[model samples]
Target: MTVRPPQNLSSLSPNAAVDVLAAEIRMEKAISLERTGEAAAKAVAILNALPLDDPERPRLLAETAEAVWGYFIQRELMGQSSHGAVIRDLAIPREVLVRLGVRRMP
Candidate 1:
């Protein structure tokens, strides 16, 4: 299953939209690697490269975080311990969650 960014992301500046799209692509690749218990360093790098002040940073961070969580859940379900650990280690920081408007989660 190929993961894609929201179409409405086009409403952002061209450069911002492109950055988000690139991050989404990396996220998809990370998901594919996770299926085989591989690391997702490239995805993390892509997401980390997004500028903090970019208008689309929050959206892109949220989307990438969701994709990472999805991969983590899938690995957990499949009993892939090491891979799940890797995903967990790459989790989005709490500051990013706050930026995404997630005040808190249970």
Candidate 2:
């Protein structure tokens, strides 16, 4: 069975979203290591070191990353290339974008 990531629902600040994106990168790297039977201790350690106030943040990152990486795996499974792979698949959806919450200049 393929694991899927949950869609982003709650809106957050830009900083929070960046943090989430960073963590997701880390999670994808870790998952790649795991699938190859390589120890992801370093990646896990790094993620654990992050000063994230939201405990759910890490899981969210992992799930999101896995979902993203799954696309690549699917492409390779179909014998595709860099261009053939839908890199745009990684593009963040507009709905998932959080407002910067800054006052606009006139």
Candidate 3:
């Protein structure tokens, strides 16, 4: 990951800036991955706790859908395009999945 030094290389070593940039990228990716995992966990918890016939179920389902949607988008950003493993691991409901990426379902 060697890069040409910038013109204003006042104090940085040849690779210092590049190294810092790489580390920052890695940290950001790690944070993104962690957030996606947390999002999936939250959606699972909400789905597991919802009552089948409760009046609030619709609202909760929409919330769950949004959370999973964010998780899927984060996964895709990290180059994980397949949802099969995560879907099985989380046991995500098809009802929620159908409404993913849609904030309001008519």
Candidate 4:
């Protein structure tokens, strides 16, 4: 998996975050040739099940952060540069992560 920032993300502007992520994920899907109507529908179903506004959202953030970070670290260990590491390790599509309203770390 090629690592990339939340797609099209130039800044952490909260308003445009979702758009950036979506573009990024879509690009990934295209590059990977994983585009399919069934896959898209399944992704929609899974996303719809997640609670986006719960007060305990931190738990979700923490878990996702760990996973993404681990992916970066693992890729680095495998000889990827920092940029490549990030692109390879991110799990959630950039779009969904931004839709979850995660503020990127400074």
Which residue runs does candidate 2 get wrong by more than 4 Å?
1-54, 83-85, 92-106
Tens digits of per-residue lDDT for model 3 on 1-106?
Answer: 8657566653787588778768889899989888878977787787778789889888888888888898888888888899999888888989988998886836
2 or 3: which has the higher TM-score?
3
Tell me the tens digit of each residue's lDDT in model 2 across 1-106.
9633335723766577768878987777666644532222233334445566777654644634444345445445544546222333334322212211222244
Tens digits of per-residue lDDT for model 1, 76-106: 5655646435635666455543443333243
Error of 3 at 6 (Å): 12
**Evaluation by TM-score, superior candidate among 3 and 4:** 3
Task: Pick the winner on lDDT between candidates 2 and 3.
Answer: 3
| Most accurate candidate by TM-score | 3
Model 1: how far residue 54 lies from native, Å: 0.9
Q: Residue by residue across 1-89, what tens digits does model 4's lDDT show?
A: 85544645656675577677788776775543332323433444444456878765555555454444444444345455454333333
lDDT of all the models against the reference? 0.58, 0.44, 0.83, 0.48
State each candidate's clash count: 0, 0, 0, 8
Candidate 3 lDDT score relative to the true structure: 0.83
Give stretches of model 1 more than 4 Å off. 1-43, 81-84, 87-92, 95-106
RMSD to true structure for each model, in Å: 16.1, 22.7, 4.4, 18.6
